[model samples]
Target chain A: MQRTTMDLWVGLFVVMGVIALMILSLKVGNLNVYNPSQSYVISGNFENIGGLKVRAPVKSAGVVVGRVTDIQFSTQTYDAVVTMSMDSRFLFPKDTFASILTSGLLGEQYIGLAAGGDEAMLKDGDKIMKTNSAMVLEELIGRFLFNKASEDDSL
Target chain B: MLLPRRLVSGIQHIGHRVIEGVWRLGVASRFFILVLLKSGTSLRRFNLVIRELYFTGVLSLIIIVVSGLFVGMVLGLQGYETLQKYGSESAVGTLVALSLVRELGPVVAALLFASRAGSAITAEIGLMKATEQLAAMGMMAVDPIARVVAPRFWSGVISMPFLAAIFSVMGVFGGYLVTVVFIGVDEGSYWSQMQSAVDFRFDIMNGFIKSCYFGVAVTAIAVFEGYDAPPTAEGVSGATTRTVVTSSLVILGLDFILTAFMFRGVS
Candidate 1:
């Protein structure tokens, strides 16, 4: 009887460990098991993706509403096409703006969504018309330097 | 002239000891293979393994959880201070979670397990040998290695992954307590940032796999030392010390190899 009781406790302990691992995988590792199959997919095209990778968070109004599911380069358009899976709970307008954004000045990049004032909501497989590519600091700095040089030359 | 002679003898002694150490490693590996083979018949010996697991694993829970909490808090506090300077204080959660999950989780837990359970295993087995209990079992036509040593060895292997998971999870909570509750950082960023940064396959799975390997190496060393020790009080105590010291070193060494294999492939 005592042995059986001890076995029960050990079993319970193992169960708790398994549950904690599950939480770690889902909450910490972003496995996204709760994202239902009914979620919608939307594509946005960008000239540059920066450091964005698959499984990046898609946030709307500072709340995570979905995830970046896939990223592919369109050969014909010569642009990076990003596919996002948005949860069914949230709906955005057909003209929603998709922007590549970073958490901080130098942190992981994610997709940020801003809803537009359109009456028609986005449906499955819809394309977001307005897209913002990742802002490259190097390109901005280079442009600033070039503008300063050109102005000095004109003077 | 005298100094040269002494130096020559010292070099010779060192060379001899290195060869002996290599031979001892070979012997230990052979013993491990034999024990693994014996464990094939260990189904009937599972009750014994469970009892040891209760002692070695369940009893070590307090120390593992407490240490995990403190480690996480320290990481959180340090991470917050460092990231605050760069205006990325919200990344504290990611910093703490990544550090704990990637490196410290398996390594620290295994170190503690070596000291707590690994030493206990060696001492227990050594004492049994010293008291001639193993010899008595042998006289009764029972295989002591199969019934006794194999169960303890396998139990340690089975328990390590669970211990490491608990350590990481508790550590995560400890970090949350500090960053979100105590420091007043935005709670959502703490969790969401960590979720997006740490990957399930590469970071978390590799950490657990490292623990399992450490588990096998540490327990094999512990049980082998116990069974190899001389049948005396001094021998039992010495074996216990060797188990703790040697297994700790092996765990650290294996961590480097495992980390290289687990991470170097990712570009």
Candidate 2:
């Protein structure tokens, strides 16, 4: 009976540990919180995605409503095309803005969605027409240097 | 400042000692392999293994939980302060979760386990040897390595992951209590943002695998030290001290190697 009691507590401890791990992975890590309804797909084009990865959060006003599903290079346009799977519950207008945003100065990149006042809502396979690429700090600095050098040359 | 003859001999002796230590390590590896084989082959010591597991694992749970909670609380408070400056205070969840899951959880848990349980295992065995209990068992036609050492080693290995898991859970709860209830960070963002940021396979499972390897290495060192210690009271105490120190250094070194290898493609 004592051995059985020990085994029961051990089993309970193991269960609790497993439960905690699931919470960490699912609730905390956001591994698989499935939406029962089917999701809608859309695509966007950006000149520079910076460090965006597939499975990155797609959020609206800091609330996550979707995930980046795929990233591809469009051969004709030489632009990075990003596909996303948005939850069925959250619907956006046709002219919603998709911007690649970093959480902090040196943090992971995610997509930020800002709603537009369009009469028509976006449908499945719709394109998010206006997309802003990630801001590149080095490129901005280089441009500033180049402009400064040109101004000096003109003088 | 030293005499030339003595200094020359000292340099030569150091060189000789390094080579001898390397050779001894190789022999220990072979002996470890034999011990591993014996552990798997033996069935008579199964009950002993269970008893050791209770002592090593069940007994060690208190220390793991308390430390894990404190560490989580500290991470939450500090992470919140840093991230709030950038107006990305919501990312505190991601910071705490990732740090615990990837690095701190396994490493800290292992360190605590080594100091608490590993040293204890070494002392217990060393005391048995000092008291000549091992010799008495040997006269009874029992293999001391199989009967005593292997069970304790195996128990230590088995206990580590469970203990680490418990520590991580307690840590997350501690983080939650601080961030959500005490600090007034948005609860939804705390959880959702963290989930979105942390990868289950790369972060969490890799930590678990790291803990498992740490378990094996620490227990092996503890058992080996106890078995090789001088059979005296001073010897047992010395061996216990060596167990904690050696296991800590080894754990830190292994954590670096594992992190380098596991996260190679990531950055």
State the C-alpha lDDT per candidate. 0.87, 0.85
Instruction: Give candidate 1's TM-score.
Output: 0.81
Q: Candidate 2 docking category?
A: acceptable
**Model 2 per-residue lDDT tens digits across residues B25-84:** 787687688679879634464666777777778888889999999999999999989988
lDDT of the structure predicted as candidate 2: 0.85
lDDT by residue (tens digit), candidate 2, A36-133: 25699999999999999877879898888888888999999999999999988899999999999987677789999999999999999999999999
lDDT score for residue B189 of model 1: 87
Clash list (residue pairs), candidate 1: none
Residue B207 accuracy (lDDT) in model 2 = 87
The clash tally of candidate 2 reads: 3
DockQ numbers for every candidate? 0.42, 0.37
Listed in order, each prediction's TM-score against the native is: 0.81, 0.78
